[model samples]
Target: MAIESVVVRQRVEDLDAAVPFYERLTGSTASRFAFAGVTLASVGPFLLFSGPDEAVRRVAGVAATLAVGDLDAAVEDAVAGGAEVVAPSAPTPNGHRAVLRHPHGGVYEYVGP
Candidate 1:
């Protein structure tokens, strides 16, 4: 599958406080959404998420979100490449997402339309 875009996710303690900074940094207003308990905003290629410690912790320090052409194929390819599945493919506001630990031990989320 071809990678479409790379989204940088930043886990923050306060969505209100974080949005302005990213908006200025990206020079664009953010599109907001809520998933599970997390408040998310998309500004340019950045995705800012804020929520409870537990929910945010799960994605903290993740390398990046790899937007791809095929979510299923990407997951399969990741597994075949010695990556470990952290979260199976599931629906999200944008599309679908699956977390994986690359063979070299980097954690990332794969997203697709």
Candidate 2:
């Protein structure tokens, strides 16, 4: 599958307070959305997330959201490449997503249309 954008994830205590910095840094206004219980904002390729500690902790320090052409195919590729699936693929505001932990222990959220 062809990889699209890689979105960096940032977990913050307050979405409102955290957005301005990203906006300034990327020189782009953030587009807002809510997924599950978390509030999200996209500024350039950065995805800022804020929500309850329990939910945030699940994705804390996640390297990046890999955008792909097909979610199922990406999940299959990840498993074949020795990545452990943390969460099965599911629908998201943008499209679909799944979480995986690489063999080296790097966790990432993969998103696809």
Candidate 3:
């Protein structure tokens, strides 16, 4: 599996309020999107999110967002290594994503074309 990039996950009360700070800090413009009732912004190496409590709770525990080379292969390898599937591979506004918990208990969100 090829790990292309890693994005730190951050939750906020409002995406509009949070994106500008990250943009200024990272010196990069934020790319915005919406998924499953939550708003998301990708700024440099940070992925900022905001939504209702229940919506946020649904995605809790994901340590970070990983950009991978191949979603299918990544999922296969993760499962082989004892990573339990939290959410199956599915399409996202940005691309494809899958959630899994590593053997050591860290949950991760993997994204790929």
Against the true structure, whose lDDT is highest? 3
Encode model 1's per-residue lDDT on 1-113: one tens digit a residue.
Answer: 67888998888778899899999998999999988777899999998998888877776758899999999998998899899999899998888999999999999999986
- Model 1 clashing-pair count: 0
Write the residue-wise lDDT of candidate 3 on 13-107 in tens digits.
Answer: 88888888999999999999877788888999998888898888766568999999999999999999899999999998889999999999999
Instruction: Go through the candidates in order and give the clash count of each.
Output: 0, 0, 0
Decoy 1 TM-score against native: 0.88
RMSD in Å for all candidates: 1.5, 1.7, 1.1
**What does candidate 3 score on TM?**
0.93
Cα lDDT, all candidates: 0.88, 0.86, 0.90
Error of 1 at 33 (Å): 1.2
lDDT of 2 by residue, 1-113 (tens): 66777988888788899999999999999999987677889999888999888777666657898888888998898899899999899887788889999989989888886
Span of ten consecutive residues with least summed lDDT in model 3? 53-62
Poorest stretch of ten by lDDT in candidate 1: 53-62
Ranking by TM-score: 3, 1, 2
Q: Kindly report which residue pairs in candidate 1 clash with one another.
A: none
TM-score of each: 0.88, 0.85, 0.93
lDDT of 3 at 37: 81
Positional deviation of residue 97's Cα in model 2 after best superposition, in angstroms: 0.5
